[model samples]
Target chain A: MASLGSIATAPLRAEREGDKNAKSIVFLGLLWFAILFAVLALVVLLVTAFFDGRTRLDADLITQYSSTVFPERAGARAAILGSAMVIVTTAALAIPLGVAAGVYLEEFADPRRWYNKLIEVNLTNLAAVPAIVYGMLTAGVALSIGLPRRVVLAGAIALALLVLPVIIITTREAMRSVPQEIRQGSLALGATPLQTVWRQTLPSAIPGIATGSILALSRALGEAAPLLLLGGLVFVTYDPNGLMSGFTTSYRSRSSTGRHSHSWRFSRSHRQPLSCFWSCCCS
Target chain B: MECDGVDVYYGDFKAVCDVSLGFGYNEITALIGPSGCGKSTLLRSLNRMNDLIPEARVEGAVTFHGQSIYAKDVDPIEVRRRIGMVFQKPNPFPKSIYDNVAYGPRVTGMKAADMDDLVEEALTRSALWDEVKDKLKQSAYGLSGGQQQRLCIARTIAVRPEVILMDEPCSALDPIATSRIEDLMAELRDDYSIIIVTHNMQQAARVADRTAFFTALADETTGDRTGLLVEYDLTNKIFSSPADERTEKYITGRFG
Candidate 1:
């Protein structure tokens, strides 16, 4: 406490007085500069992304989908709803399985067992696996399962596999932060293993596990590759009405908005597609 | 309750070796030793609490009432309920004091009608009733360190275990707090059998009926330290005229 007071009361050292405090002050300034730079960059990007097409955006933008022939009729409603449905379904598919696996590993598994050690190592490697790999894996599994190639469920399945390892890891990490003493106390009371975990461990880890799963889901939401594999990048003039129906993402459709209508200054014929998508691509 | 030829290990690393001790019924036994002597490890093994550690392995038989607790049919959870534990640090659940005391009984399927009485009896037994009675609904974290430790004791006793294992329960507390806990131990000695692992010899002298002295055998070259029990006797004899020279040195504060 005395040393802290001395440091706080110390005189400002700058320029020729180049002491450790001078370096410390400079480091603090650099930290502020770094923070401001990151914040400013994000603000600029968000402003452009939101307001760039804001003047032309309306209820129709959220109620319709892109069209190949009529640019004025094109909207991003299908894509927006598609992403939302896919994310929600992804969370449902992933959270339960991840939490179960984490509880088993943290609360039950014998670490000395070779299989348990293998699982620990594999989860770390899986978290780093490329999103595109999951996209390919999803494509194969979806085809094998006889699921429609382009659907919200297939997109969600891809993302669930992508984020599963992360949720398990985070759940384990969260549960681990709860001191072992709590578990012992619960068990010493003669609470069954499942009861102890359900009553004590899981309750405490809920916030941490929730935070981790949210972060993982957000990361998955930003990923377009898996969704693209499910034909998410294509232009759809119709909204998805079922789990197996085709869909798109606003990532391209919103930007694709005003492409041939208001945002364009060039000849309209060059940007507008024919009603047939294949020939439109050929052209 | 007794363990015969008990050896505790973390994976292949032997922490404590070849320890055999019998805990007398309704008595306080202090397991005293320096750091790394595995007194805590042995205490944990008695109630099958060591099984919680994935790598921790306990070899040999730990029997409670003539039944080997390590037998496949003997559930560790059931054993833990029969033998409770108090930890070095005061770790009350982030719960109301009333709920904290009720947690054990609630899980063990105690009748709702009997719960209020049980919580009160446990708190009163631990000498924390008067202070916390007004704030039973308040969070247990609001209590002082000494009070939290006592609350933990109350929580443990709420289930009515036959034995209680205390691993440095008073070390985190002040002297006054330590004395309060020691006095509580003396009062509790007529009911539950207690096995306490303590670093304070004076504390052992004050509260324990029997004292077991442990020491670590160190291999300087390999840097391996394995704990072994040096002596076990009546507390007075161990403190005054110990059989082993090492025990005498340790008791006199002349041993490293």
Candidate 2:
């Protein structure tokens, strides 16, 4: 009987010890997570401050464009122009197309349909694919069409393809967030389904779609790989005068509405057809 | 208003079956029933609100102003524009109080100069102008439940609809708010045909000119559940001494 008591007590003592150790481990894990987060945040802050604190940054960065090695000549003019061209073109191509596709999928397409499910799965997978793959595809297509391998148009197209999935996903989520009741309410008021979507549902989702487009544009702006593959010139001395020209001048001009309305005429003209194709093709 | 052999189906499940009722112009008609008894469904069918549900199928002839509403050429949008609805939950749009009242007018292309006068008239008629006159630009979502419901009523009135449908508009409001809405309904009955569905028998007794009692029936052959109107008559007659034993039992809380 004494031996049995000792056996049970021995296991109980081990369990108690184990519980104490487990608690300590959890406490340590939480402490480590906090320390790691703080360190990462500090690193990001320091890097940003260091870049922003440079004395060389001035109006020259905005006005005199180029990346000359000489300190006096070095400016972000061409880089800014290139970035603007890419970003604007991306927005012109991506926003309408992405949003239309998203709306069709979320509002019109049946989720249970095999074709719709296939399209949805493909879009998700496309979002995860590397941007470089898109660049390669663009290059191949351009080459086949007897066009130059590395052109602004090619880069814009590549970037659009790369970010299209993301824009669609975000737009779908935004449209989905609108209450079903709101749609019903609008329809009940005798508004046509098209009118209900355009006036009620779409208006409510504008903020979300705008936010998504901005995020996609920001990602496209910072991307170096696809542009590098598309032969984005690192240095350009003059501003682009036409759709076929390389980025040469920054185009971030202020408008009356305080919104970034890009004046890329070529891209804007292409928007209607591209959006139509996007909705039809995707759905 | 008249419904001839109207049946409502949600996909294959029959929700309301074989209902025929007529509502007079400028009269308050109240539909009262237990939960899932198709009172709301029947009410929604009046304005074709059931069309919003993809699977909801309605089979019958509903005539408005001596014209069949379900005719092939009839535009549901126009019908809805003529027949306005106030929902059970008092859903005011997420806009300014003034905007909420002006939405219907704006959608129908009412002149901008006329909107201010229209908004004020609707709000006054709904009895909300006195409380919200100082804050016309404020968000409609900030209003109390009662106030929001009144705003919805004001919104419906702005469209100048001929008929107004209320699906338990006061179900979510307090008694004071309910009384306010009831008063507004009485006022509105002079200008518009009002059809209300309510679970509260007392509310129907207080405001309705005519009361309809609907009950669910289980079909043995088809094994389907459907709603059918049990009895409808003058509100006082139905409340005080109903001819049907079931109506008396239901009103007296003896059984549903």
Candidate 3:
């Protein structure tokens, strides 16, 4: 009976092999086409940027401040500084808050509760809201209370609102990747929940949190729509020194301590978050 | 030590029902049954290890040295500190071999000098001292499966718990490792009250002073499954001449 069955199925197996080889050929063809298309699009973008603006791009272009009536002399120094300040402050504020919230939601919170579901849904929606809306809210509410209008701090709070959901989502995923057995082992050894999370869970989840925070900060750095409403200039030679100094500084300083200290610290820290931020804004 | 009317439940489903048994001081008691017989569940309930699971619930009383473990305000952590556990799969932490053994003592706030001596004593008792002494700082994950299981045994001993609960400690090991662990169990009975759960009947016959056989029953109305203790006696008598027909069938390998 076994020999008869094998004879009957042999030709079907051979035919199936032929079909598999044909399907593989089609899959490889599609893969090559995708790679070629991606390369072509990248080449087109680089070539166009070079041909259209190459002559105008230089040190003077970066150094000179913008005049509303003179577009040609407008530099990106103030805009760059504004972007930097907002991103750094946002990261400083959001990472701890978002990661804590994520940890609570994933590890500690009971999903069956109504309030947790509400928070989860609201965060998802907040992530999708337009950046300009956050800017308007920050300018109207944050500035009116005590934070001066058009300073980096207000912009930071706005950007933090925009990127917090991303950090939370990524952090939750990272925390989830840690095996349940590890947590159980720690708890079984008589450690409290807080101790287990702080000692075992957090250390293992750090690499994931760092990667997510970097991605969120990069997105915040390149954002201009919210910053436009939050009052970032195209060019300012001097950097804002700190939150207080930036709020008080006038529009016409040749050199600000904020830029000097930031540049110095950037060179010193050499960490991925700092370098990645530099690449985002400088490029 | 006695477990009085102990019942374990997972959400709405009861896993083990109305089990009452006593383990003598400095004696080994083995709970043997087929797969899905609630032997492991009953074993975990002895030390309150099932508390780690979100929905697992335990009722009734487990007493250690005549003190009730399930009383209100009894700290589960304190219970676990007094009653240690070793699991089927060797789950040594991703730490050095020295750290693995030292972890329990450190948590209880033992001084460094005492911890050093305890680590050495525990490792020596488990027969793993010579194999890992030279590379005490190496990661425990680098050790072979048998060595890792023995390291777990050493880790449990370092805390100096009054009772040690083991759940299929030798199931994942080879025959040689199994023999070593069996030997260790025999040696350990001099100081600790040992309760072991194993599917291997021969292991229970060899190392256990008292053996309890458990079996599952299905409720007629609800069709819910729950485990019940079938028989309990001296290890030799239970194997050679069981009181119940079910126990005889299980012992003879005719049915489980």
Candidate 4:
């Protein structure tokens, strides 16, 4: 009780004692410096990118095609469409499967089983496997399976695999966050273990699952490294109409155009806003 | 309900050793002990709730009526259905009052048609229907702490379990709520066989028909701890004249 009371009043006494300590002020300043350091970098990137691409912030940026004929009329319409399709397809493939795998591991899988232990170790290591490796794997599989190269399906599949581990891990964490008491309450009421999980634990974990899934999706969306390895749809001039339609990502359009077309490139001297605008969006 | 030389273990460490007790039909039996005494563990083992813990295992015979519950052929789900429990905290599902009580029956494959009557009877029996009946559609979380516990009890009883195990059910509740629950327990004593694990001696004396005293003995040399059942008898007799020194010390608040 005395210790608890001391803890309650400790802050006031701490500041009084801290008044004469110059090290404390330095420590506070160092903490603020650390905070501002990170914030400043992100702010600078966004602000510079914003200023450089302010003129290209028009419907033309999204609606125009990538054109050698008329570079100004060139828009990222195809890439935007392609990225959206790939992300949607990736979500469709990953969400249910990842969440299900997560639920299985957390709720049912026994660590005593050798196969389950192997899976547990593999999940952690799989999350560390580079996204580009998935793209290469997708490419090899697509070639072996006689599927066409450079289509939206290839990109979606690669991204889905890339994010699957993340989704599973997050879903497991989310489900784990639901208090065990809830499970006990359900089971104590004669509900089966399956029923307890389905009715109580899952619903309670949804908010956490949603937050985790969105973070994983956003990270996948911003990625450009994986798309580089997949075939044909690198720089498209038309909108993606289907899963098989040839397409370019918004990042790919800017990067490919910048690499091949030097005159339209956004070098330091020539701060072409549309090219930098896509870079900002990707970051 | 009876357990013969039952021992509970978590992994290789024995939590409770050679514990035995029998509960009478339609009686409230209280298990009182300090922390780490495994009173809660013994309570959980009664309905096979210990099966939920991966490392937990039990030995010896635990029987409901004449049938050994731990027998290989007996379905644990069926055992749990016959013996329900209420936890220390009031953990109502994040659902409406009606849905919370309706959950137990619905999960047990009881028909939806008879659910209304069961829910009402459960709530009334647990002394929560009058307060919550008007807003059955409202979230169970909106109720006060005491009210939520009664609702939990109502939900537990909705499935019509023969025995109810309570693990410090009123520990989180205030005095008023605690008293209400105590009153409800007396009313419930006519129908349900109850075994409650309580830390409070007064609560055990106030409500329990029979009381079992438990204490954890720690080895000084090895630093190993195991829970032992000290004494059990009529509530009055155990309180007034305990059989074991540990039980007498604990009841007199001198054991520590």
Local accuracy by lDDT, each model: 0.85, 0.81, 0.79, 0.86
In TM-score terms, which candidate is top? Answer: 4
How do the residues B115-191 of candidate 1 rate in per-residue lDDT, one tens digit apiece? 88999999999999999999999999999999999999999999889999999999999999999999999988889
**Best candidate, lDDT-wise?**
4
* Per-model TM-score versus the true fold: 0.85, 0.82, 0.84, 0.88
lDDT order of candidates, best first? 4, 1, 2, 3
TM-score of 1: 0.85
Pairs with steric clashes in candidate 3: none
Order of the predicted models by DockQ, top scorer first: 4, 1, 3, 2
| Poorly placed runs, candidate 1 (over 4 Å) | A1-16, A19-40, A46-54, A64-74, A251-283, B11-13, B219-223
Kindly indicate the candidate among 2 and 4 with the higher TM-score: 4
lDDT for each residue of candidate 2 in A165-186, tens digit (9 for 90 to 100):
9999999999999987677666
Native-to-model Cα distance after best TM-score fit, residue B175 in candidate 2, in Å: 0.6
Deviation from truth (RMSD, Å), model 3: 7.2
Runs of candidate 3 exceeding 4 Å displacement? A1-27, A47-80, A245-283
TM-score of 4: 0.88
- Ranked by lDDT, the better of candidates 3 and 4 is 4
- Candidate 2, residue B207: how far the Cα is off, in Å: 0.8
Output the better candidate (1/2) by TM-score: 1
